[model samples]
Target: MTSFITPCDSLADVRSAIDQIDAMLVDLLAERGRYVREAARFKRNQAEVAAPDRVKQVIDKALAHALESGAEPEVVEAVYRSMVAAFIQIESRQHQALQARQAPDAGTMSGCICA
Candidate 1:
């Protein structure tokens, strides 16, 4: 039902390969967010909301990995910076919803600063 193909052997082939890879990355990202949502239920306090420092640390590590892997540092940084920002927003929202459900009377539980 499926077959394996090697990397692009020409410019057009390379473009096509890149497109396919991008699609796979999109799917993986969706799966990653699903897990993020599950983790959302555990963030009881608002302090655990956004955590810019943690995001920065993650971005730094991602950039380092990108460089070490011979990927374009600027491109990697840009992509991850945006990606992390978006995820943080999603995480914060999900955390808030969870906390509200778990503690309806409590006003904003405490944790890390949101981004």
Candidate 2:
């Protein structure tokens, strides 16, 4: 749950609060990154790494949570879409790496990831 903060009385205070929140966001993203790395192990190829249905499900859940938390849905949707896209790329790389390690002489997985 998000913690409540007091109203800012000055620009410096506002910036400080934003910085703190950003730091927290970075920390959260790092934790999420670790999980993404682990998720790569379960995926067999780029297609599974970039599962469009799973992406939609994640966005759907995020949008619902945005409504529940009084967040702007448009901003939430935009951020999630971009973040998910980037994570898909990262996960794709990890998936390729894992596949290579499992069969080093076989080479990278073939075919593009398609929905």
Candidate 3:
């Protein structure tokens, strides 16, 4: 669970808080993207993305953290799944790009990029 500081007494304070939140979100998402790339490499190599053991580990850890932070487990799970789905979509796009780059036929290259 991410905790944010918000001083909503003034418009300036609200704007400042929002700016800070945007920065934090960017930083966190960038970090998560790095992990997504690493995971994509594994996925490209034909390794499983939805391993039950790994998913269980994540859910258990998230649940524990959410409990400690007074956050709802279901809310955390929903947010996490949404973020993960976005990452996976990015990963799939990257994999497609790599495949297009490696294609032996030049016609496929233009088709992929144009599409």
TM-score ranking of the models:
2, 1, 3
Point out the worst 10-residue segment of candidate 3 by lDDT: 43-52
- lDDT per residue (tens digit) for residues 23-60 in model 3: 99899999989886667555543235544466567777
Write the residue-wise lDDT of candidate 1 on 13-114 in tens digits: 988988989999999999989987787777766567577787789889988888777778999999988888888788888998876667745555577488
What's the candidate order when arranged by decreasing lDDT?
2, 1, 3
lDDT of 2: 0.89
lDDT of each: 0.81, 0.89, 0.73
* Candidate maximizing lDDT: 2
Which residues of candidate 3, in runs, are more than 4 Å off?
1-8, 11-15, 44-47, 50-52, 99-115
Question: 2 in model 3: Cα distance from truth in Å?
Answer: 10
* Poorest stretch of ten by lDDT in candidate 2: 103-112
The runs of at least 3 residues in candidate 1 whose Cα sits more than 4 Å from the true structure, single-residue gaps closed, are 1-11, 105-115
Indicate the worst ten consecutive residues by lDDT in candidate 1: 103-112
Give the residue spans of candidate 2 off by over 4 A.
1-3, 104-115
TM-score pick, better of 1 and 2: 2
